[model samples]
Target: MDQKLPTIKEIAKRLNISVSTVSRALHNHPRIGLRTKMQVQKLAEELHYEPNTLAISFKQKKWFTIGVILPELNEQFFSQAISGIEDVATAQNYTVLIGQSHDSMERERMLVEAFRKHRVDGIVLSMAKNTDDYQHLEVLDKYNIPLVYFDRIPKGGQALSVSSNIRSGAEQAVRYLLEKGHKRIALLKGPDSLIASAQRQEGYTSALKQHGLQLDPDLIKEIDLSPEGTRAALTQLLALPQRPTAILCFNDYVCFDAIQAARQAKIRINKDISFVSFANLPICNFLDVPPLASVEQHPYRQGQLAAEMLLDIVEKRKTITDIKPVILDTELRIF
Candidate 1:
């Protein structure tokens, strides 16, 4: 390979300063000294040091900047989550660097690497839909930077996590439907790649078992989330010999599609079929006729807790591995 570009480790070594000092100076952090920042900048310019060229940080010196990477920013759930994260970061006098992965694992990895290269104090991440491998995340460990996962986390508890008690939320919703006299309840399952969705599937089965309802595999459909896909799933569910009286959707977005399809099929929502969804986004409250109920996932709370856990470790006030997970409980919203 061609001569490798200069890195922060080399720059810090040459300047006789900590990597965090170099990172803070480069980013013009307020806590850094004027003379130190100028010196670090001069040395960085001379070395042509780019963020991507760095892979290290200073001991006992934090840059006070956090990186937040999530699946998509446009969605209401992610947007609300970001607000919670920002609230916590602002209170702590820390800057947040946000990146959207758009549910692409490659994009998520790139963002994580970029954050690492910039020497972020820590990262708060909600993994992408296709993030089946997590070898890339090991870089944070090598560098000793902390990370906290929320919402859609990876397998094996690789990092501190904050999320809604998803299984309990699903169980609560299913039990509520049963109380409403819905025996043949259909489920629209999300992709298996998401841990939260998988947990919800298990909760659905557990609720059925708890209530002595026989498991009906045919009543469960994997939702591609496309309009066509939602329509097809609904069509199949309605055509069953004993059509379901209620449907449990993966999320509010899927429930919205189900409502539209149910209406197109001339089924009056409350009269002909009942529905329940997860993730109580604000959009659902604005619906003219909301689903009979939805499980309040508290995405904002998840984000808040995720940021808090990462900051605790980043500031060395707590150890991530030793910290207990912050699991936010859900509420059932009946419309």
Candidate 2:
């Protein structure tokens, strides 16, 4: 009976050769004789030998697998970023296992533990919206797994991260609104727990200050990223005695809520109020009035860069002697 999936040791025993010799022959090592190489290969094929990656990894301590944790994949930003990550991972012969946190810290923590249990060589992560505390991430240190963050990263951390320059993007957006002669600019800011949101808020204020425009305390409202939250903020802003002439939304999708709010309040968009936000969605261009402008944070390239950094650390090709942020810029659209 054919031995089940012959091993290098088994083939060596059958051929009366050393296991090292059998291994070398199987790999076509330069030291192995061509005839001997052919013989070992033929026997391996006949025996239906298949190398065990998991067993091999036990020795090398590298699974050649990367765990990628995303907030969610429904948005084009995340989908594009994942595509970029896959591009680099596949080329490097590293398998990617994906986990979605659904913007929940608890789920993210569980996913981290699961990835650690699998002994992934490294991890690529984008934090959840409510992830203010990063204690859950410390678990990876115990397993010596390299980690890198893309987009939605934390304000404080030693790990490397790739992200769009949200501050600059928001500054640009605010400036664009100012140039159009809109002084009363309201910010539809995201939750303070999000670093991106904080940066965008910072940029909004910075631009207003730079242009000699006073920052209105009441004009800035925190968006919960929910329809109800958006509606409330919009209603409050519209009800103000001095309603903002331009609204800087947190994201493209939030613009939809802004538009809805304006319609119900009988406020004209672009004519009465303009909207500018981040990650210009595809539908942004197709909207009836479209956004005055939007920030194009290139999520795909952010993912690609994050993967490159993580792989470098995992391979020890480039050691991060000192911790530093790797910031990427938002892509520019024609209009």
Root-mean-square deviation per candidate: 7.7, 2.4
- In Å, residue 16's CA in model 2 sits off its true spot by 5.4
Clashing pairs in 1: 20-58
Q: Clashes in candidate 2: how many?
A: 0
Give lDDT tens digits, candidate 2, residues 110-192.
Answer: 99999998989899999998898888897677778878998888887456898889999989999888898999999999899
lDDT of 1 at 165: 82
Which residues of candidate 1, in runs, are more than 4 Å off?
1-60
For 107-186, candidate 1 gives per-residue lDDT tens digits of 99999999998888889999987788888887788998888899888766545888888889889989999998989999
| lDDT score for residue 77 of model 1 | 90
True lDDT of residue 216, candidate 1: 93
